[model samples]
Target: MAEAQKPDLGPDPSLLILDDDESFLRRLAKAMEKRGFAVDIAGSVADGKARVTTNPPAYAVIDLRLEDGNGLDVVEQLREARPDARIVVLTGYGAIATAVAAVKAGATDYLSKPADAGDVTNALLAMTEDMPPPPENPMSADRVRWEHIQRVYELCDRNVSETARRLNMHRRTLQRILAKRSPR
Candidate 1:
């Protein structure tokens, strides 16, 4: 005799995605939904905070920089509101200082920008005690330097002269490097 079909389990718990980049947020939300999470997307800190206050998700992916404010604020609120929620902070301007701050602020994990859906998912689901192995092929020295320079450039509010002065490099040189695409 044929066995009876099992009942379908509903989608997993809610997952909040906060990012200022419209395209990236939309894509990631769809991907997370496909992976069984019920996703809520927020493009700013205010929106994220309101959502969390209304109904905090079980998991969250928050961008370090938001249009209205820093993502750390959201992280702190989420921690206060939902201590059990797993929070992963994503940043294009990755730095040791900020990473420490994020973790201290209650982030379960921190990932640099360009993190794909799979990476975000893994980070969110990883057990607190289980640390994943480092990447086999880390970024090359040149790529690292480029990323650093770009990060500083952004922090300087995209002012080429200011970024150059902050980095102690010539403006022309900084411009040249910025003109080139990031090295593989």
Candidate 2:
């Protein structure tokens, strides 16, 4: 028998692309739109903010630096205006400090430009994918927990001490978390 059709599990309803560079914005818009997304482009922070206020998109692609202001400011504004909107930050000069700040500020993800359409699309999908059932539903808690531990570990770039510091826990405590998360 054939498998039943799944419901529309697409990225988002629409995309709001913000960048000072017109060519980049246009290309990204065209690419994303071709992939079944509704895309809107804004050339400046003010313009982007205005568009979002009028009609918010499901996701926003932001540049780290803008002609009028910094991209992080735009990220903050977008979060304030539409908390549910997923934000992806773009920067030509990727800084670890900025990446960390962006996450704390509620960015779903960050990418260093010259990113292509595929990278943006994948990140959006990953951020907005349906949540899997929690541990004990189907997947093993140990496995899931280990995955989480690994992700956090990698986020701190495999520095357990730094990861613990970032998590606001003692290094030994973070070690225990990892140990508990590990498969028996």
TM for every model, in the order presented, reads 0.84, 0.63
Taking the tens digit of each residue's C-alpha lDDT, what string does model 2 give over 11-125? Answer: 5667889999989999999987776677888888898878878887788898888899877777787788889887889876555787998888878888866678777776666
Off by over 4 Å in 2: 1-12, 128-184
Q: For model 1, how does the per-residue alpha-carbon lDDT over 1-184 read when each residue is reduced to its tens digit?
A: 1123311224446889999999999999998777778889999999999999999888999999998999999999999999999999999877899999999999999998788877887788778999854544556789889999988988899999999999999999999999999998
- Candidates in order have lDDT scores of 0.88, 0.75
Q: Candidate 1 overall Cα lDDT vs. reference?
A: 0.88
Candidate whose TM-score is highest: 1
- lDDT of candidate 1 at residue 104, scale 0 to 100: 100
Clashing residue pairs found in predicted model 1: none
CA deviation > 4 Å runs, candidate 1: 1-12, 133-140, 157-172
